[model samples]
Target: MRIPTLNHILPALAIFVSGAAFAGDLKIDVSVPADRQGLVMAAVFDKADGFPRGTPLRTATAKPVQGKATLQFTDLPKGDYAVTAFLDENSNTRLDANLFGIPTELYGFSRNARNMAGPPPFAEAAFRMEDNAQQQAFELK
Candidate 1:
C-alpha cells in the first residue's frame, strides 16, 4: 500500500485525539436552604492543589427553583473531580465572608463533606468520573 500524505494522516489523528477528550457529563444537584434565594455557583476541580481557591477546570451557575438548583459540566474527560458550590444570596460572584473570615453565605461540597474547623480536605470531596454520566448531590450548610 502507498504511504498516506501528512495532510491525510493529520486529520485522522486530530479526530481521534479530540474524541478521547469528550468523555462524559457531570450533573450536580444542589439543595439550597429555604431561607436563601439567589444565584447558585459551582466549581469543578481536577486537582488538590489550589482547590477551592484558584480557577476550577469548569464552572457552572444556575438560579435556585424552590430551594433547589441543578448544574451540569459537559464533555469532561474521565478522571477525578471535586465540587464546591454556594448560594450567592446577595448576587455577588464571590462567596461572602464574615469579619472572622467565616463564610456567611450558604455553601456545600461534593459528597456533602464538611469540617468543624474549616472546609473539608480535597480527598474528602473527590469523586471519580468514569465512562458514563455521573451525578452527585450536596445540601447547603
Candidate 2:
C-alpha cells in the first residue's frame, strides 16, 4: 500500500528473482558400473530424496562408459536434495533382481549409503545447494 516502500523491497526481490534464474541446472557427475548392456539412468531429486524408497525429484537417462556418467537436472530448485541411478540393463524402467534379492541392475545412491536390509532415509542422502549453480559426484554402490 506504500508507494515509496517499493524502493526498499527491490533488493530482496532481486535476490529472489536471481535464485529462480538458476532453479534447475543442477549438474551431477555419476560414476557407476553398468550392466552388460552399458545403459544407465540417473534419478535426481530436488526437495524429496528417494531413499529406503528411491523416490526421485527428476530422472535423466544416459549411456555410461567405463562405469561412469555425467547427469544433469535442469530447472532444479535450490535446496536440499539427492540422486540415484540404476544400470537399467533390461531397459524395463525398473531395477530387476534375482530370487536372492540381489539387484540384477547395478544400482546406487548419493553419499554411497548402502543399507544391508533396506534403502537409506532421505536425511542420510540429503545435501544442500548453497549456490545458484550446484555440482556433485555420486558413486553407485
Candidate 3:
C-alpha cells in the first residue's frame, strides 16, 4: 500500500474535526407517577418560532421504569435547544385535554417552565448545548 500524502491526510482530518466540533448528545430523565401507564415522549426544539407546539427538530420515546423514563438524543448540533415531554397514557400519539382545553394528561417542559394560560415560551425553556454531553430532567404535571 502507498503511504498517505499530506493533502489526503489533511483533508480527512479537517472533515472529521469539523463534524465533531458541532455535535453533542443530550440525556433526559422524566419522572412520572407510578400509577401512570404508557410511553413517555420527548421532543427537542431548535428555535423559538413555533416553539413547544410546532414541529420539533428531533423526538424520542421510552417506557418508564420505577417511575422514571430515560431517553437520549445523539449527534445534535451544538446550539440552543428546548425540550417538551408528555406521558401518552392512551398511546394516541397526542396529549389529551379536557373540554376546557386544559391538559388532562401529564406533561412538562425543559427547566420545568410553566404558564397558567398555556405552554411556556421557548425562551423560558431554552438551554445551551455547548459540551459533548448534557442532561435535562422533567417532572410531568
Listed in order, each prediction's TM-score against the native is: 0.91, 0.73, 0.89
- Badly placed stretches (over 4 Å) of model 2 are 1-24, 34-36, 47-55
Q: Is candidate 1 or candidate 2 better by TM-score?
A: 1
Top model by TM-score, which number? 1
Instruction: List, residue by residue over 45-88, the lDDT tens digit for candidate 3.
Output: 99999888899999999999999999999988889999999999
Strongest candidate by lDDT: 3
Lowest-scoring 10 consecutive residues by lDDT in candidate 2? 45-54
Query: Which residue ranges in model 1 land beyond 4 Å of their true spot?
Result: 1-4
- True lDDT of residue 139, candidate 3: 94
Candidate 2, 1-141: lDDT as tens digits: 757588789999998997675655677777875445656787766655234355666778887777677777776666778777777767688878789878876777777767777666666777777676777777765
RMSD of 2: 4.4
lDDT of 2: 0.71
lDDT ranking, high to low? 3, 1, 2
**Predicted candidate 1 versus true structure: per-residue lDDT over 1-141, tens digit per residue:** 989999999999999998787668999999997777889999999999988887899899999888889999998987889999999888869999999989999999999999899888889999988876889999888
